[model samples]
Target: MADEATFTQLKDKVVEVRHYIHQHPELSDQEFETTKYITNYLTKLGYRIITPEKLNTGVIAEIGQGKPVVGLRSDIDALPIKEATGLPYASVNDGVMHACGHDFHITSLLGAAEVLAQEKDSLKGTIRLVFQPAEETHVGAQEVDAAGGADGIDAIIGFHNKPDLGVGEIGLLPGGLMAAVDQFKVTFKGIGTHAAMPQFGKDPIIALSGTVNAIQTIVSRNENPQKTAVVSITHIEGGSTWNVLPEEAWFEGTVRTFDGEARKTAKKRFYEIVNGQAASYGVDVEIEWIEGPDVVDNDPQLTKWVVDETSKHLTVVKPEPSNAGEDFAYFSQKIPSVFAFVGSHGNSDWHHSDLRLDDEGLIPGVKWYYYNAKRLLAELGKE
Candidate 1:
């Protein structure tokens, strides 16, 4: 266990950094100001900073020197949601806020960096601190991977704040932590017709109605009874007037699955149901699939490492698999990675305008990263 006085000192720094980031929120890849703040802070802490050209707003800082480098990651970008928390550190930028708690993630890493820097001389292996950008758009992890962020990295660790969990508790899911996310849009084309004479032209609105209803059957009938998949048609637009039949109707929705086989099967069934229904109505359909993050699968061994280290500082609980998606899945693809969740103690859901995190829960998160890196370095023969 760390000294009480030292822990208090580090916790104070964490709060300072968190509040600073909370007040000034940047969105997605356009995190110029946020990147500058992180770079300067790490440099001041005496770490070797690497700012890759590919990710203009991403920063990777290292402390100590040796093989089997352990990585700690945090996202720096904010979402496009408006803040209604009424906290003094509420987002200063209108229409932008840290609703997902990336503000705390980055600040926690910053605090860990400070502690790691103090013990740099005694450390055996290196710690790579990754300050990522555009996590809301699911582009940061991909960009970091492309920029060689995972090079020579033996194992990676990351965490997100969960509002449903109680403060001082850590949640870990061993196998499939999060689901794969994919989106799609379908456009139905038909002939326009006047309101008085319906038989003269084909009605796309009628075809869309059948398509939506049939799409639901794909989940109920095509998928296995045990397997889970979600297909939601969130948007539908078509006729301009109440009586006139429009020439086209557009529908968009998302798909979530746990495994590769399930993802492939769901996509196949979706297209078949949508296109088949359109053809039956004598209407042509165009379908477009938007790619998203893969499911986040934690390495069993790495999960154990996180659980052990987290237990030292707080109460740890194993959680069920989540349907949500995370870009961190990209890193898990390259190396053994563990993605855990810190308690947020909020009643509202994530990505909501009123989403708020318990500031007190952040200290334990900082300790987890700080101590987890120490344990990982020891295991890798760096300590």
Candidate 2:
């Protein structure tokens, strides 16, 4: 346990920094100001910084020396949500808010970095701090890895803030902590005619509706009943006015699954169903499939170690696997990694404008990052 004075000071600093970041939120791939702020802060802590050449929006810094590199990461992107919290430090930038508690992630990692910096000389191996960007779009981790972010790192640790859990509690799962994400956009093109005349035109909207309903079968009938998969059509648009049938209609949505075979099966069935529906409706069809990150499978051994050590300091829970997509899956694929969920004690869930998080969560969060990295470095040094 941290001393009261050190804990209080760290908590105060995290809150102040979080509020400043919350007010000036930046969207993915456009986190220039956020990058600058993080760079300046890490530089003052006397860490060596590395800015990836492929992108100018993310920051990576390192401290300590010698072998057995360990990484701690935090995402640094905001959503396109308007501020609804109405707090004093609510987003000043319109149409952008830290609805996902990324501000908390950044502050916690920064707090850990501050304490770790003070113990740099005594530390055994290199500790890399990764401030990843464009996570919401699911490409940041890939870009970072391509730029050699995880090149020499032996192991990495990351965490997300879970509103469902309370402060001082964390969620840990060994395999498949989060699902893979995939998206599809389908357009049905048909002849346009007067709405009153049914036979005069083939209605694309009808085809779209039929396709949407049929695609649900991908999960219910086509996919294995025991496996988990989701197909949700979240967006649909067609027609200019009620009087005329539009020439084209389009619908877009996402698919999530844990197993690679399940993901492939769902996508194949989706294409077939949409094409079959289009043929039956006598409409031309075009499908755009956007493949995203794979499942966030935590390293079993590393995760077990996390559960054992973290349980000693905080309340550890075995959380159910999440269907949400995370780009950190890319990093996990490359090296040994453990991703946990730290409790934020919020009433609203992630990506909601009304989301709130207690500052007290930082107490456990910073300690986890600091102590976990320190111990991991020591353990790696032995091997």
Q: lDDT: which candidate is best?
A: 2
lDDT of 1 at 99: 86
Relative to the true structure, how large is the alpha-carbon lDDT of every model? Answer: 0.86, 0.91
* All candidates: TM-score: 0.96, 0.95
Model 2 segments more than 4 A misplaced:
1-5
> Per-residue lDDT of 79-150 in model 2, one digit per residue for the tens?
999989989999999999999999989999999998888888888899999999999999899888888877
For model 2, where is the 10-residue window of minimal lDDT?
1-10
Candidate 1, backbone clash total: 1
Model 1 spans > 4 angstroms off: none
TM-score of 2: 0.95
- Tens-place lDDT digits, model 1, residues 102-207: 9989888888888888898888788999898888899999899889876888989989888888888889868778889999999999999997787998888889
* Predicted structure with the largest TM-score when compared to the true one: 1
